[model samples]
Target chain A: MLPYGLVTIEDRVARLLTELPPNPQFPTQGATLFVDLARRQVRQAYTPRRIIETFLAGRGANMFYLYRLLDESLDPIDPSVPLIFGSGVLTGIVPSAARGNATSWSPESGVLMDSNAGDYFPSFLKMNGIDHLVIYGRADAWTVLWLGDGQVEFRDATPYLGLDNIDMRDRIATDLGGTWTRDLAMANITRAGENQVLTSAIMAGPKACYARGGPGAKMGSLKMKAIVVQGQTHDFETAQPYKQYNKEIATKLLNTSVVKNALRTMGTPFLYRPSRVLGAMGTKNNQETTWTDRLDAENITPYRPGMAGCFRCPVNCRPLNQLNDDQADRYGRGDGPEYVTLGKFGPNVGIDQVEPVIRLNNICNDLGLDTASTGSAIAWAMELYQRGIVSKSDTGGLELTWGDAELVERLLFAMSHREGFGNVLADSTRAIERGHYPTEARKYCMAVKGLMQSDPHDARILKAFALGLAVSTRGMDHLRNRVTLEINARINDDPGFKAKLYGGPVSAQPNNYETKERAVRVCENIYGVGDAVGMCRFTTKLFNSPSLPGLEEFSSQIANVTGLEFDADVLDRIGLNIMGVERLINHRLGVRRSDDTLPDRWFDEEITVGAYKTEKIDRQEFDAMLSRFYAISGLSDEGVPAEAWRQELELVLSGPA
Target chain B: MSITVRLPTTLQTSGQDSLTITEPVENIAELVRVLRRQLPGFPAQWDDSMLNFSVNDEVVLHRAEERVLASGDVVEIILALSGGTPVPRSAC
Candidate 1:
């Protein structure tokens, strides 16, 4: 009894039988695409009885698709396996920030990780008369997939291969023969992908990037050169129901003055000071708990003109600034030394000057290198040099001195080209730890689960964030569980209000041990939903929009979008399902609770300078928080989500959680 | 005879985007009081405990009580937390 004009299974099967090639990749069994008349296209469709049911059902569907695509091998550890990008029912149609998600086997953490970008992809796909694109297997040569209006063409882009992101973008625009507009089309990857850098990211829009887990490298490994999507319009279908929903949410979001103010003014960079002040900004290879006063003074003083932002984003946090006269002459303009870049490249490398950090950020961006990983690797090298494990002879006579801009520039170039010492540094701190200087390298490698830390938020003042990073599928990422709200609340002048929001007394602060478990759990669950839908966490986290919805609201959005009567409980189950499947993926990969831990220095050393001096996160408290987090997440004592949780998610038994 | 009182980045817009202005004051406290008269909301944004007034790059943390202001001292009232919060007025 579905809508009559909707593409039915019979119709699609008939079309496929006639039109599909002998080597088509669609799974013949265990999955079916349905044409919901209301939706007007063929898509993987399911109806769950409750929130838990939907979660389990959706995750089961995705896992089944993943396994079938991988030739029925259920090993998550297999690097050759394809990454399945899935969106929850509410994804594109939802008025809130909840939008799109990317699910892949993470090379960094060696587990299935889900990360969210912005809403552009989901909305575009929906508008294009498609639900999802299941990318399977590696390509044989450097190729670009152009999904234009009503046609998808695969072109050989070997000529543009080995180019950096900025150049690649320019080349694509020139070849495509149009002025590229930011009206929700897709393009990503560069020569960094060609190099197969594990931390390399695909840049989209001007600043929006599919940053985590080397999607670019994955594309490069497949011999896929680039993906150019065009003809996608920004306008959504304005049905009566859609109009009503958009109006209500838009009115609510615009009405909230504080939310609007915070986003429109400071953007995500506001966290820089708070994180630094609270001793959370990772510094000196995560060895330094707080940045020096001089470092802060140099970085934050410049009054730059003009603001930049992602497509359709109201908060223009990206600052286009001029550093020194030389830099202005070179790059012409610089794209932000944003919080992560500033903290990672500046204080982490022991550089106190803002201009150098700005230059370093621009170089990394232009070279298509991840600043966080790049900075951490360089910091490790510096530490090794200082400790005599690495000498001037090792560095080719270049002094790895703190606050030296010239040394930083040389090292960055060396790392990019994999030249001399840069070859060793290019492999990341984790790889370096396994190399000859294990003891010295291990002391400075500031990463959890192989991925380097992002943000300068001190783990001591922000224990929940530390715990989240420890347990994140992609190693030490801030997005998995951004505990900024809890930290901000605890640090506010109003102790009673802070206690009310975070659930504790002033002295027994949530920033301390007592409340970290619950805090992380809430953040993870909300973020998990965001990831499943592929929404940007910045819009959700900073804007304080109704992105982190409870089960009922999630269901309502899905119901509104697809015209499916999904229950509220079904939405909650979807989150549980995604987490459970990811845990199983990690388990299959041999990841255990021991893998979920912070570097030793975070526990042993106290912050020596800045506002929160002498503060250190306690190891016992961190462990206790992990235990509680696992229990609440329906995971085992070993930090694996339980079988019952898996069953609740309705995923087929592939392996242990 | 008066000394020039320098404004912080946040309040620079109100003083016609000028960094320094001639103000009739004998001490730092008097200068602050004069600044408050000129700018109504200046004192509320500052914390006295953390406030460190400077004169030509020198810390005058305790100089409000002991040191008398000279005609051309180049007094600067620097807020420790200027960059931390979003300033309402434009730095333009």
Candidate 2:
């Protein structure tokens, strides 16, 4: 009785077939998949050209789609909450364009949110001729959605239940295709998601994940376990222009020494050396700001298996590591121990040893827990214990001590399973702030708007970074609005260049408060565009490298790949519009000017050690900066988008629900 | 003035992370000059503009020549790249 003509071999399984109408503008020709698991209904329809044109792809598309799906009546944790998957238009066709986005209402933040990942999943999604996938409604039983050969299959995921992400992917691939399935990609969750932990991540490919904003919890709420994709590859190399363009980009990436020597050779651990010396990282749960080099990248080189990249990426910045040490050997091999992981599990918890950090990262990856949040949660508890706020009696007879790697690992598992004291950690900082010691412990928890400020870097001195983190829609995320160039002394000293870039004199000094709002605004715009297009920030100009691609390159690539005439200004506007849309969604969720603020510790506590010792956010300066940012972002003094912004965003949101 | 000069792994050639510059250097520019003279393997192409000189954890962001250094100062010379280790910016 399905409208699209369902075919059923068994009463439990259902399939819907539909024809795609050709649209010259869309590369996918408006291919969209809609699945309602509660009703066991599936439908395929042409995505409106207006939606594609206005939103573009990836997060840009998600912003509009998520906004439309979200209503005042819809609870953030409702089982019917829409989970969206989208890819950039240029994905699979261009280098460094393989990143994908998953959008849903964050159960933790109580707001619409999206997290991105880089891997074969996005490429396979695009190659399989599906540009956008939307799944909603709770299934009667655990289900896995298989996308391949221009069709979708609903497979019972009961057998895959309770399996880790890696196991689930391997088993699903073997069951659906084979051991050597070609071009098969999988995104799955683990025990953490099954337990509905707020910090769970959707593991894409082997290591990449849409980790932020708790997208895995949304997937779990729908009784979904994994999504498997197998698609035919497109040979754009046959086209001479496309081939030459890809070569040009690949050559540029290789030519950049940062990419070749530092990023590719050492991966994200390359930042460890700088962060250690510069005192950029938060140590011991923001109580300290410096750590020794025991956890340096050079120490990790021995265990690194090899470098891996997403789809057509040339940078290959991820190191697929194999732990060699006796303690870490049991966790087995996995990707990452990214810089954030190094800081979060290492210095943040006072664990200087490299192996323990790797073990912690691997455990999080295996259990589908976010290392940032997990580390933060444990660090918060340790600090609470240190301050004598909590004791062994309250912790189920477990002493929360700093540098206790064994306890950290055990707590990660406990948090995943919501066991004992780990249940408190799994509920996020807000729950603890309100439920536990509201006054004494709240000051110690470094969270903004319920989401833990995951970046291990202390932002007290990094004024632009602090401002960016404060105003980020998803709450306290670095990638959204970090003006990395603020720390580059060479760039900062060049007044003319700075003025041209930011439209004003933005200081290069990390502690300077003047003109930072301008820099933050510009960075917000660039990141908006970057996220929309699914470009990894590391591969873009945002990463303090002039050689990497930015708006100009993206504009040209979009033209070459999609035949769309989206100039840099248009892209900038689209990014800006996406920001406005996100703010509007949050506004509807009761977010106000008060919500656009940082943690109390950022302003109250001074960094004990570092080059920027005694540095903290000046309340007046931060307030002024926030006001300026709002003014420039076309928002009212109260943090609401002005009428002009509303009209412009409404124009984009006006087309086809 | 005996100053401690710490070099990043990428810049080190003497198989050491740090060296003692016993020579008197008034500012970061002079310190760089002394470094180039003392360390034979120091890249001659590097200039004050290319490096971030942090004196006792305080970064000399503008006009390194004007920022005065004192005896017993710990000078950490890192690359201008904010997110990564020291590398020649010209290669980009």
- lDDT, model 1, position A103: 52
Itemize residue pairs with steric clashes in candidate 2. A611-B57
| lDDT on C-alpha atoms for all candidate structures | 0.55, 0.75
Model 1 lDDT tens row, B10-57? 455555533444666676666666666676446543322213355544
Give Cα distance to truth, residue B71, candidate 2, Å.
5.7
Q: Which stretches of candidate 1 lie over 4 Å from their true place?
A: A1-53, A56-79, A86-99, A119-123, A182-184, A238-240, A251-262, A292-303, A322-330, A433-436, A489-511, A541-556, A564-573, A650-657, B1-92
Candidate 1 chain A, run of 10 with poorest lDDT: A23-32
Task: State the interface C-alpha RMSD of candidate 1.
Answer: 11.5
Please give the lDDT score at residue A94 for candidate 2: 73
Name the 10 consecutive residues with the lowest summed lDDT in model 2 chain A. Answer: A9-18
Per-model tally of clashing residue pairs: 25, 1
Give the candidate number with the greatest lDDT: 2
